[model samples]
Target: MAVSTPPRRASRAPTEPGSARPPGRGRGLLARATLLLAVPAVVVLVVFFVVPALRLLWLSVTTPEPGLGNYTAILTDEVSLTVVLRTLGMAAIVTVVCLLVAYPYAYLMTIVSGRWRAVLLAVVLIPFWTSLMARTFAWVVLLQDNGLVNTVLGAVGIGPLRMLGTTAGVTVAMAQVMLPFVVLPVYTTMRGIDRKLVDAALSLGARPVAAFRQVYLPLSFPGVAAGATLVMVLSLGFYVTPSLVGSPQQSMLAQFISVQVNQLVNFGAAGALAVALLVVTLVLLGGVALLTRTRGTRSSAGAGVAGGLV
Candidate 1:
């Protein structure tokens, strides 16, 4: 009757601090590593980009007696205003041209298999591997009087088309040089699209053109915006291609800045021009951002509806 077994004792499991990660412990480590990697990049950007930009801004106001002299020159001087306008105009034209040409090529590339796509991509990227100066020089050979283009024109009974040292020449040269920048981005965006969605649209009685317009184009807007912005910005700063292929009257802001710096020996004016160009680029980029935001909202809304239906 007194043979009752001793009550078994229950043991609790021991918990280690490492086993129970305090809420965001993993996130903390990731954040720390990200910061560690970013610090050097941030430092370099500050040292090189931010510092130089501030110095340029300072020079724009401070030169030839400190008090808005350079900025006033930008407004009052007809030559400066003309150069600014021309640069903006050319940049706009180039952006539009690049978009029009790149879209079809990008769309075609997206429809092909991966291996074929890579080959096409290589073709697009090959020019980048070559020297930009050499590429521009090659254009000179192609567009020069009695060169390939002119020879072809002559054969067609079109008297030698004077292409060199013309705005047309500059546009053609700049467009060719900047095209890949446009194509790659559009191609990348297009590649991310679901082929099934387009097929679904077609299966639902939507024509191919309608499917593309309704489905694909909206998805590709971000890429189009990115590529256009890139080409336009680069076109704005173009010096070599414009100088070699463009007329003296076609001199862009970069060429104008170069003249002030090297020939006129006016670092102040050079800095002023640089600041003006920088401001224009910032404004254009801001405009692009605004436009993209508006379009992106619409695209997102449409996508949400489409996703729900699917």
Candidate 2:
């Protein structure tokens, strides 16, 4: 004969006064702890970036007897309009140039052996480790009249192309700096791509070029979009390269803003321009974010369909 034990008691969490402990309490505690760890970073951003940005925004309206006249002038003034247009045009050109050069190089990186790929990557990255001023001055040296670049061009019957202190010089310098940003993203995307899909396309009687165009190029759009957006946005506010390599006539929005601040002491106008720039940046970021999201969704759906077929 066996004796049955008393029924096992239900386990309950320790209760506080007038309340029972809730479910997922451990998770709640963990989240609070994580938030606590983030406090320093939040504090730093608030103290540094957020506060300064808000202050600037406040100055945009207040510094010159409190009106939106600064913004109105930006829209109406010919010189200000020209600078804005020039900035947009330069950023677009640099983005296109970087994309054109980066795609092939990134593809090369994907196709090469490990050693060669590392070398290529290092070539892309070495600029970051160098001084920006040094690089700009180096470009200046190469670009100046009677410099090594002109000398080479002179040998080739294209001597003294007048690249220095021109839009062309600014474009070249900006492109050089922005290229690595494009390459890194595209290479990362291309590296993870499934080449087997292209092989399958080829097995279906498609030519190599056709297979690549149909299979690989479309797959790399996310990275391409990301890199292009990065380069374009960064090129907008570029000051150093353009200031050194370009002239007053070639001034972009950043230099215009600088002139208002340093030369004219028009802080209100500068703040307005800065706010305008910040607005444009936010708009571009929002548009690209939507585009990338759509692309990502399409990619995911395509992958799911392909998996189902397999």
Candidate 3:
């Protein structure tokens, strides 16, 4: 009755939580793959952006007879100071204008039907479809003396304005182009807002505006901060619209940098101003990041309180 039994198969050991991964599934495999995928983009960025930026910084201090003379001029020269201040001022105005125009439009997008939302979204994004040059030129036409804008204004007894070479025209064009930047971010934030919270606020006898102010507005603020920062930074470096619509007297830092490059051929001064502008942009972005972080913390706390109420 004794039959020869087949040799017993070897039992595999169970993997423990802290155990090493199997050969093909190494612990760091995903990280290595991610690094591999990012290598090309990292190389491109270093070659293009980082290399040019380093050269620019080197030129700022070393070119055109060396020393810190170029940076000093940016700080001490009256023309440079004026242009720098003007650029900052204009950027602030553009940021404010974009935010003012975007906030309500974005809020509306969140409340509308799907089809209407699509239409509104397309409207917000229309500027991106056309070329920047084309859009700037279109603004040039509309902003020229006796152009549609001035003509409409004239009908209301406002005589043909010198809109083509004015800060106002430049502001209008800049705001329009920068609007979509603000709108898209704000809309995304608004869309994520819990409608039930607003309803709950209403049920608690809060006024419509009060509910929005207390419950919804705080939640949407990070988007506002992000959009505003983007618009402000872009406006600081804006050249085409301002150069096209603004006068030499109303020129911003970008135009000043261009003059140094193309007109005066002062590469050192150009680099210095460019560095200054870049520094300011970075500072703004950092400030916005800090603000958004604080706001996000507050928002999360508020959201938690609201959620508990629900």
Candidate 4:
């Protein structure tokens, strides 16, 4: 009895595979809350956007004798092709003009002081605060035969030229409308760029132009891509400005769609035109995204290599 050892302590067994799992109560509540918030947005999108878009597609196929007639018109009709070509051409021109104007403007904004930068940004956004239709009407007033622009031209001894009803008029108006979109993105990107990189290029005997082309331009390519895509896409669907300022020959697909819907009562043709415009826009955007992605990847790889060498 005296020599009896103390009772051996028992070893505890490890927890079973699923026994240590955390309780799902908190996670379940979180998930339920997320679903509750998201469902309304999903429902709205489905009801208003997805449903109407699908209806447009169905109309394109089912209307006008339930064949591909509307789509066929796009290829077979010379007038349709001409309108499409003109729309694309105008969009391209507007995009180019906006980019050219916006790039330097954006670059300047980056170099300016913070107070002036905010003022400049406010100026860019002023047009956005006003009604777009009103802005378009203002363009019409300026471009009209006896309007301010024409009066100025006459005062300068030049004959009052027809600005309205020309592609140039459309381009000018569209470019002005789209300028803010182009400028903001480029400016944002430029602001984020390291100024030291530019300074280093200069210190290395690179000219300002070379430094910009070699360093700044490559870095700002994403902004350029974004702005160009934005302007082009918006220009494609421009209706009010073009209608107010452009001639029948300068009519875009959006105007054509409107004519079919409102004038001819041809919903099928209108739907088909809408679908065609959407497809073309998607293709252009996809191409631009691909090109931007390729350029971005190359830039990243080059940066990595240069970093490694250093």
lDDT, candidate 3, at 125 = 79
| Order of quality (TM-score) | 2, 3, 4, 1
lDDT of each: 0.74, 0.74, 0.75, 0.75
Kindly provide the TM-score of model 2 when superposed on the true structure, using C-alpha atoms: 0.86
lDDT of 2 by residue, 1-310 (tens): 0111110101011111112212323567676675566566566666865677677677777878797777777777888767777877888899999999999999999989999999999999999678777888899999999888899999998967899998888899889988887998788778778889888999999999998888898888767877887787788778888898899878887888889889999887777777776666556666777766666577872332212211
User: In model 4, where is the ten-residue run with the lowest total lDDT?
Assistant: 1-10
Candidate 1 lDDT score relative to the true structure? 0.74
- Model 1: per-residue Cα lDDT over 1-310, one tens digit each: 0111111100111111122222333467676675565566566666865687677677667777797777778767889878878888888888888888899989889888889888988887898788888999999999999899999889999969889988788888889888998898787777778899899999999999999899888888777878887787778778888888887777887888888878988767777778777666656667777777677677763332212211
**Best of the candidates, lDDT:** 3
Off by over 4 Å in 1: 1-43, 301-310
Candidate 3 lDDT, 163-204, residue by residue in tens: 888888999999998898889877877878889999999999
lDDT: the better of candidates 1 and 3: 3
Error of 4 at 41 (Å): 2.0
> Can you give the lDDT of residue 5 in candidate 2?
12
Superposed by TM-score, candidate 3 places the C-alpha of residue 45 at a distance from the truth, in angstroms, of: 2.4
